[model samples]
Target: MKKRKTLLLPLARQFTVILILFTLCTVCITIYSTFGYSRLQTSFLNNSLESYSAQLAKSTREAYESYENICYSIAYSQVVQNYLMSENRGKSYENYRQLENQLSNTALLNPYIIDIAVYGQDSTFASLCGSASNYEEFSRSLSDSRFPYRSAGVATVNRTLCHVLAMPIYSLGTGESRYLGILFLAIDVNNLLGNSLKSDENDYDPRILFTDASGQLIYGEPQLYDALCREEDRSDVFQIQETSDNPVTYAVTGYSIPGIEHTLYVLIDKSQITRQVARISGRQLLVMCAITFLALLFLFLLYRPLIRSLKQLTDFMNTISSGDRRAMKEGAVIHQGLIGSKEISEISTAFNDMLIETEKLNHTIFDTYTRMYELENNNRKTEIAFLRSQINPHFLYNTLTMICGLAAEGMDDKIISVTGALSRIFRYSIKGSDMVTLEEEMSIVRSYLMIQKERFEDRFTVRYEFSEDSHDCLIPKMVIQPLVENAIVHGLEKSLEPGELLIGAGRNPEHGYLAIWIFDTGVGMPESRLTELRESIHRSVYNKTGDASADLEDLNSQNHESIGILNVNSRMVLYYGTDYTLLIDSEEGVGTNIQIRVPYRLKSDTNARAAQNTNSKGENHVPGNCD
Candidate 1:
């Protein structure tokens, strides 16, 4: 018998290769079409700019010619020539009136002509239609000109920007053409060029500019003229790429007027072309996506049987890998009875068997992990409780010793006060919850400070600063009192002068954390001892093991003076992690500042508990008040 060939796998490989090639070809075609379309659009824009610039140049030339003809007619008219050639031109009213009439009639040819004037050779002059304040200057400029028949450039006339046109007048009826005077016409630039440059289309904003032979702006925006002059190539048409200051790109074209020394430029915004290309490219991309989708659909139909079986297996494996406990417990397996190929049937059978074995192993591992997590959590809680217990005894021993000293002196009133305050401290510390509101915490701190005041007498005073908003923020119990006790014993007791103990509680606006600080103005420790104490506290926080109670015992044996601060640091780290640990700063002569920072949290039943605690105590809680 002849060996049979399997065509399914090879056919699938070929289909993949075809899809990849199709994708590459589609990308190449899109890129080529976009590039070609951009170039075509740019060319079309350049041509449009060129045609528009020519139209502007034509309109500007016509305006110039019309104004020049008016000057020529006024300069050569018999009435104006007679006025300039007369012996006494300014003195004769009839001559002035006739001369003014001729100039006025000639200016009527163009409404843009704002002023007309004629100067005589003997310092005599006549004006019509506008001011003649600068007629003498105009005449002198013309007479001193290298070319008397040319324009005198632009000037301001009657507070309006105008183009000055000068034409020389000679004595009529004379054998020799003798110089008589000059005729001046002040033409309004805005009225002349404004209509010609206004664009009718709204797609692109076009800017028209006119510059003289020396590149100075004759009319229009000086900025556009300056940009045109900066171009290295003086081509008739070019593009100004987008700039930082001016985000709009422009296609610029220049045209020289037929009868003047001025060049006109038309700048059309090129963003319109970019928008057009983007729209075209978008359409092309849509069509390509549709074609690709149809092709993929056809391929999927051709290989539906093979793909369907593989997809089922893939989905089941994904469910198991994603740790879906419900699916694993239900023992969902792929039934291979529907599979047509022997190889796929074998794969389905092996996968089903492997899933059964994996489910069993998964349960065993999960049970072990759960047990480990529970044991670790319980150990951490026990360690924190043991740390809290350590603080109560250390504090009570000091208070009891002070009470004994007071009894020896026979101070009955002071002894009563100390015992009462100690009673309040004991009640507050022996509460069930490890967390309490900051208001309750500060209340206990006040009782502790009151007892210290009785023992020290005039040796130290207490000051309290607390924000009202931080009264209800939750913090670990017995955290602040230990630091306060430490400061009194180690810091204030050694000082001879009267010292001040500052206890403050507030919310840190920067970190949104509750802050409690104890500061003492007494003798401080040296840097060496401060470093050693800080290292010991941090080591206790990091070296926690399964047995935190044992760790606390080891910490207590190392340092006597630092036990209170170390106990506070370790408890905070255990309850709130290392981020809420205590920060200690001290100087040899300045004293110590121990600050505790904890996240701002409030217990859900804080109000109810607070009311209950207050009712039982028969008094309202007062924070930071010592009498």
Candidate 2:
């Protein structure tokens, strides 16, 4: 029974989570864009205010320069100078009637000028006292003051703010270099600044303030005097800042009027920039919202089919888990709507094909197992039949020939022993099993060697070296006897001198194998001959195209190498696998040594590879006979 999952969520709820995540991403992007735009707009407005302040300052400077030029005109005039140094020095400037009339006409021509006054510098009775305004206050104000040339700034006149331009008077003609008296001109703010600054569109004109080099106030709106004075700084340049208690932002900048000793400060409002930001922000919000809505709609359309296909696949997989073959085929039609997408279609097709293949493979697997059993049985029958064919008449014929030759020589004892060893060898080879204990195979090898020693008593010496631990090891039958036989027939039989033959059986410490060696101190072959013999053994072992079938002809080959060493090598390979090799090492005129290695498994251990050397890898090898 399957346990119900407690944490499982429906597909719609899962999609709802996706929708929420998408909305969060949209909100984050919107907030980031809005923040960046606000910063850019603020920076632009700050820069625009600086430019507007500079332009206003320039206009204010031009307005104030006109007053300075008027002051210079009177100071350098020849008519004004002669009148100041009148022959009638005893009289006041009123006695010079033409000078008074000239001053009054100058003031009338320029409506901006509030008053034009000239005061005498003489230590004696003062000369050339005149006022353009025809006001007694101008005379009284002028009489008390003494100023240097080019002194220009803003001042209060008749309880009204005014721009004042002043300059020193020089003597006429030859006395032009000499200073005589000071000339003064005061211009009304409304008349002088209105044309350039005041707009009919709005009352919000940028106020221009004037101050002399000494930092004294010259001219500005009287109402703004206190506020501006409070915010006054030592530096000539201005900055935009919010007022201490006001919501509005204001900017100020100062410019020095050329050729005049005055600084003009232009103050502008900052609300003009704020209005633009509000308008831009409104438009941006509308555009972003519309895009976000469209994006959400697109996401819904995109993921809707995917979610439905996945839901169908999930249900189909659940039914598949219950071993329903119908669900696999049914899945194709269920998610058919998603087939337009290549990846989804491939996934669906693969899922169905895999399930179908798995079902067909179920029956094919049993057939394969049955075939494997039949093949193993055939291999066993083939190996036994090969051994029966090789060992029966041919081996008996060799023994009978040896016995008949011995009988002709009248050696009855030799024939009896040889016949006994030959009979034991034939019986062991014909046994239907391919496994034998190291002790049992060594007994057979000794019996066989005993017969050879009798036949060649004076030709060679035979020695045995067997380790006690390896005596009971299970290995392939007749694996070592052939190597000893080869040493006797090929090595000692051909040599003129008596040879030494050694047979050794021991545990190979480096590998899990029983090492059996046969060494002969006879005339050995060269390195080239040894390599040739090694290749011959390899060909016989791997005789078949594949090791799937047993090659019976490999055991029955009558070639000298194929008869003894090759047969031994091929049989050991077929039984103990290729890791077991019949290694032959020889040197010219020194000796020849042959080593046969087989897996060392104990006879008493039922789980280990026993006589047949069969293991879990399905390796079942037969007992092989050698010359």
- Could you tell me which residue pairs clash in candidate 2? 93-129, 154-218, 434-623, 435-611
Runs with alpha carbons beyond 4 Å of true place in candidate 1? 1-304, 317-326, 330-358, 391-398, 405-411, 604-627
Q: Which lDDT tens digits does candidate 1 get at residues 1-627?
A: 999996565545766787788878877887787678767866776676566667777878888877766767777877877676666636566778888777777777778888887766666767664555566566666665335455667777777888777777876674968777677788787777777656666355577777766666878776666666777785544555356674656667677765557777777666776776677677877787788779778766655556566667778778978977677556544444443456666787777677788767767888988998898788877777766766456457878998899899998888898899988877776666888888888888888888877667789988889898788888999898899888888898888878889998888788878888999998999999999998898788787666766787778876878888998998888788888899999998889999999997767657788889889766655667531
Top lDDT model: 1
lDDT of each: 0.76, 0.68
- Give lDDT tens digits, candidate 2, residues 294-333: 9888877777777787677777888888877666545554
Clashes of each: 0, 4
